[model samples]
Target: MDYKYLLLVLSLSVILILSTAQHENIPYEDVPDICAKCVCLTAHDTDKRYHHLLSCTSKKFQHILARWPEEFGKKHDNVDIVATFSGNNIELLQQLPATNATLTFSCRHCGIKYLQAPTFMDVPFIRRLDLSWNEIASDELTPDVFRGPYRVTHYESIALVDLDLSHNQLHALDRKIFEHTANLTKLNLSYNEFRVLNAPTISALSSATELQELDLSHTAIKSLSAAIFKSLVNLRILNLSGNDLTSVPDKLQLIGRSLVSLNLAQNPIARFTEESFIGLKSLQRLNISYMPVLKTIGKSVFTRLETLKRLDCSHNPKLVEFDLESLTHSSNLTNFDISYCALTTISLFVNVTQESHTDIATLAKPWPHLHTFQSIGNPWYCDCDLIQTMEYIGTEGDTKINQARCDTPYFLAGALVSNLSSQYICNLKIPKQYKAILEEPPRFLRKRYIILTVIVAAVVISVGVMLGFAIAAIRRRLKRDDFGVEPIRYTSVRSSNLSAFSQGNTNSIIVNGNGVANASA
Candidate 1:
């Protein structure tokens, strides 16, 4: 009876364990439709949903569509897909099988030589697309390269928001390339061979009216048409650095309403006039560094930028004067860099932080918002005037001023201004007496020297007379001893004392009581 009960209990435990295992395997059965779903990896989200990610990067995929899996898209209609085909050997990208899904596709570094309308026929929605580092040419591509047969309107044809086509050999671009893609917000076409951006190019780019961030750097672009960027009214960050621009492009005024950051570094701009930045009232950050030929900048060029925060004007060795007064209107300035500009004095730069320099009532403290001043690599004159400025630096705790080195006044060369001594400053200035003498004539100097000599001689004669009287008084006191000196004043000695004076000498003196003196021979 005991063995029978034990067997029954063991069977019941085995059945319970099998039931739990069956329930755990039910989720996989519900997930179907795996057609052409070549997911490289799958990740679980916080809500326990699986995200399918596919990448053919560096796989040397040739004609990816030809190798499409047979079981792709079996049951599922909508899915999340992230696809990458970078660093592949795919030359031509033709029509892809249609799918209604959110997608992010990257084809950078793919040796694609041709792209047709059906290239993305299967892909209707693309949030981000990267086609950089390819061999696509401007003339070979049509404006409707991404247009699908079913997409009738501009919004239905192009759903791409971010596109990158950098590092290509494109010399000119067609306006129709972006005509169907009016919703693009960010575009990067940097590192191309575009020599000039004329009216046609500007008109072509105007189709994307909602563009916010654009990068055109290192493109060898020489000039831009006036008001070329007028259509991109929503642009905020524009990068034109590393170009051949000779001046601030006049077309920038079109986007001045919303531009926040402008990079103009690595150009050959010779001067900055007031009209150069006339319409950049909303600009906050400006980079004009590394300009080899930049020498002159107008005093009021930055007056319009009332909300300016950071200004980088470094690495321009020919720049001499940067009028701080012109920036009085820029009350929101925080970070300023003027390093390596060959400045002769820190007076102009340092004094701008004081209350006397600006009329802004909000600036109660010295550079209240300024955190860093990269003013190093400049030839600072460390005279008495600069010493006062250094003291202010040591006392102020908020401002981080560094690399404040001296380049002139041989004694203070290579020395930091914060460590200078008071004695050294005093030694550098001329003495008051010498300075006064230098101002006087030679005839006045001679008269002054004669008067000084006469005063010194009179003082010496007075001292000599007082010394003679003191010596005579001392000698008279010695003569008035207790001995009788009436008989002879020669030596206070009597006749009996004559032997003590003579002894064995033949010539001797003798004195009697009658006060007469005789010599014995």
Candidate 2:
């Protein structure tokens, strides 16, 4: 029985060894050797779709591979492949490698000056391409450089959704350069050398009807064409900051229906006219801060912005005049930031005069939904009108008043508005109608008055008591003198009589009853 059991065990062991060898002989996909110096990762995107990323950034490579290895896309079915070749010294962007899988290509900061035609012909499924931070000029981009292969004898465009060509030497583009990218949605051309965006140059982008976001900041653009953005009906977000625009671009109503956010900060805009943003009814957030020459925001500048929620006009050193009534038209305004400006005071009533009574009914309620009001870093004049306006706003809404320091009236300078009483802020300037709001004298002042009154009363009482005592003493002295005067007279008469008796003249002599005065007569 032991010999039989050993034979059975040996047979099972041989079967296991043969099975392992057979499994090892089966074909399995491995990482391609062309990406030996690159880091490969299989990660998931925001939609939970798995994709392969090959990063070859800062590898000191002077050239890119002309073609990818065969069977690369056959191994991974329905998976995207993204290849990056950024921060290399490759001066020329030649034909790209072919791949059957959906591909995304990026080659930023490669010092590339030339782009050969038909660059992406072999990469039929290319979706996104990034060529930012290169030296490609306008003349280097041929018309057919972005075109893909034709499908079913008719031109079928590639599936490119995003293209970034920012930070290049491109001054202009051919009107037909982007004809093949009908599905493009986002394009970044910021930090380029566009001094002026002429109508023809802007017309080149009219074909991208689906484009939503465009960045044109810091391009030294002086002005825009009147109808430059009229064709981009689907455009939503636009960044025009850090430019030389002296005023709002004309004819913005062309894209006003679809625009949601606009950034006009760091410009040289002097003021906003009543019709500056007339047709932008869908706008939500606006940033017009950091303008060195901005001065005024007129009364009707924001009259039509009923849907605006946030407004940032901070950091303007010359912005001294802002009509508080201008905000009354925007009923849905929530966050307002006017910090670091030159605003002295903000009042809801129009044409407000100092030292005058304000009717409660006349005061309008602006910013009914206001929550945060940032008024710090400004020279606020904490007068009665300003205090009253703030109190009204605080009571009507849930907005928190910022702790702005006073800069006028000399006495309240550097004092926080929240810590100051309305009476103290207004002092004698408070109107007669609102005198009931004035509080009693300060605690220290009341204490000082009590002390002074007590001292005065004690001095008066002490003086009265001393005067009474002096009068009584004078009366007693008078009585004593009256009683002693008759005796003195009697003595004088007796002495005189005695003298007369001695001189034999005793007619006027008088004596006391009990003690007889013996006369010599």
| Top candidate by lDDT | 2
| Candidate 2 global lDDT | 0.77
Cα lDDT tens digits for candidate 2, 168-189: 9988878777787888888888
Tens digits of per-residue lDDT for model 1, 451-474: 887888888988898899998887
TM per prediction: 0.66, 0.68
* Model 2 regions more than 4 Å off: 1-36, 44-48, 66-77, 152-154, 350-365, 392-403, 421-424, 427-521
Model 2, residue 426: C-alpha shift (Å): 3.8
| Model 1 stretches with alpha carbons more than 4 Å out | 1-39, 44-50, 65-79, 149-155, 346-363, 384-398, 420-521
- Model 2 residue 108 lDDT score: 99
Each prediction's total of clashing residue pairs, residues at least 3 apart in sequence or on different chains, is 7, 0
Q: Rate the local accuracy (lDDT) of all candidates.
A: 0.70, 0.77
What clash pairs does model 2 have?
none
